[model samples]
Target: MLPISALSGAPIVGRATVASIRLRLPLPEQLPPAVRDHIEAHAGSQNRQYLYVPSPVIADQDASAPLCAFVSIDYASDAETELVEVSRGKMLKSFLKQNFSRDADGDQILAALFHMVEHLPCYLLRYSDVVAAAQALETAFANGDAPSLMMPVLPAVENVELGWGDSEPDQPLVRRAQATVVDLEGEAFGVSADQRNIVHLDKGALRVLGLFDVRTREREVVDILSAAFPTVDAAQIENDVSGAVRRFRRAGLLVAT
Candidate 1:
């Protein structure tokens, strides 16, 4: 469990073993000497050790402005795991003031900051790659060349039915299940499940899954998402949705329409 201070949005100020660090981009070589020194002084002695850096909450002056970064970090210890937040805006501003010329363009600075943070280690899937692929898919959709898509869940195989008397009638039942793809020879692979082996779903992918209806068209789904998360970029959402669909399809959880 995280300290109540951290849970309530206070800066972490102690030693912790991190499981992962998700930065908007990797640490830049040109970081302000003070900030870099602070990080190095604070970093664990072990090489490649995970460090948690929380996603900073930005108060956008313009409500219509798009977010530049959404980074997160996960810390794991023998007892539990916690996420530590960092402010991307403050971090970038510190670096820019220290490293760049005052005449630098705002867009250029933002781009540079994004590029710098983009190098953080990702254990499973790189969100930047997902965003890139999503951009390409968005282009295809705009060109009226989007592919037909479908969402499929695990299918019933060799069902073992249960009777109503299996448990108390008024008791609420919680179902925990796992699904795996089996080859022609009945060998299983690509297993995902709840409880001990839950598959990880990023925010965008979770949203897509929530909106998914079997055999739903990509365009229609995108439209629905546009209405739901009005502040988010449609193209980015589309990319995340398409990426999840592709992953599921590859895992045999989805099929082409």
Candidate 2:
């Protein structure tokens, strides 16, 4: 016997997939008056919070002049910050010893110290034992024994070295040199290896030295000078060149080939 199926007339529907579409909305040209006003107020508040305002520590100064600067602190840990503070304390102490009065008040001292560390002359203290050198330099200026204001010719040297020596009460104090080159405001300086003293070369000295070549005779230095200073008398230029060569040789910065 065969079984009979009942109510088999139901409709069968096929499955269909739906695709998704994204729509980008355009910004409005204008906002409501109140909404626009609220937005402007918010922007003004942000500006007030983040705007750069110069320190008002000075009085009657030009607004354009920067008396004090700000630097942001960035450190990975508390130890790093502490290390920086320690270094700053040492630098401040060193700077005060060389430049400021011993009896200055705490506020004045701090202000001056801050200025020194923030300025270009600060590098002298940072890089070298400059307390003695600074005193000697000042004395030289006072005694009129300073190097000639006029520029000098420079001779090429094989090496520069720095050394330190004990200072005697009766003798002039000289800065102890280190075994490194000092770069100050873009000027390169080296201590003489033979003399164990610091040597400084100015722009004019560097310019004159740049002309030196193996084929250039020592006497030809004056010729180079003539080209450098066409307006100056040849005799005076020659004398200056000769003086420079002697000075450099004595300092052991230059050697005869």
Candidate 3:
């Protein structure tokens, strides 16, 4: 799958793993980096819940409320029963909505998780991808923008190789086939197939890349471009196509047959 790190507000695509964090708070606000870092590093990996207390209460070290928050992560393919959120108070559902939004109904965040996470009978605001998404929430604060709903995700980089490549026969190379393209301040950015790298394509390369796909042969791609710009020489079109395909494949942006 394609990494969504490139789509994040902070968008630092590198050799990073994806993890989840849930924030249980009365209201939404900017999470200091210290808090975020503390949660990311100390949070248990066994899917156990952790009591997170911000600056004022970090020293106390308990799930006591009115100030602190609870932190937890959900993994893909986890084996928990119900999709329900288990908390001391059922009213905490609203916190789940605003912090990790999904759709306009403010429930879109969990909509995707509904298919993946195990049942948790507790009060918590879960994140499908906190590394990327935590920055998203902080983005609104940094830019002074209004809060919005999103299930903002990052590639769940598992320590285990979830699976291997697909079994298809001689599939044609496709451009951005298992990828997503986004505009970062007018620049075109995308993720690699392995979901570990971020790549940027220039206007020329991107335009050429768009012309190739699993269903289209390389010759047809060249022909399409040639007909589109009749003034350009056919040889030039072929070279452009070849160059883009080579660069894209090397960067994992284009699939190889």
**Which digits, one per residue and each the tens of the lDDT, describe model 2 over residues 143-252?**
44211121112223344331122212122212222223344345444335322333455555544444442324445666777987899998887766555544444444
TM-score of 2: 0.30
Candidate 1 structure quality by residue, lDDT tens digits, 1-257: 11111111222121232333343334545456765666666554333534444323433332221222223423222212222334433333344454443554443333333333332211211232333433543543354431222112223332333222222212322221343322212212232331111123445655554444344555566778889889999888777656665554433333333
The C-alpha local distance difference test score for the whole of candidate 1 amounts to 0.37
The TM-scores of all predictions, comma-separated, are: 0.26, 0.30, 0.34
Best-matching candidate per lDDT: 3
Q: Supply candidate 3's per-residue lDDT for 184.
A: 36
By lDDT, rank the candidates, best first: 3, 1, 2
Each candidate: what lDDT?
0.37, 0.36, 0.44
Return the clash pairs for model 2, or none: 161-191, 163-177
TM-score of 1: 0.26
Between prediction 1 and prediction 2, which has the larger lDDT?
1
lDDT digits (tens) for residues 55-76 of candidate 3 = 3222232222111122233433
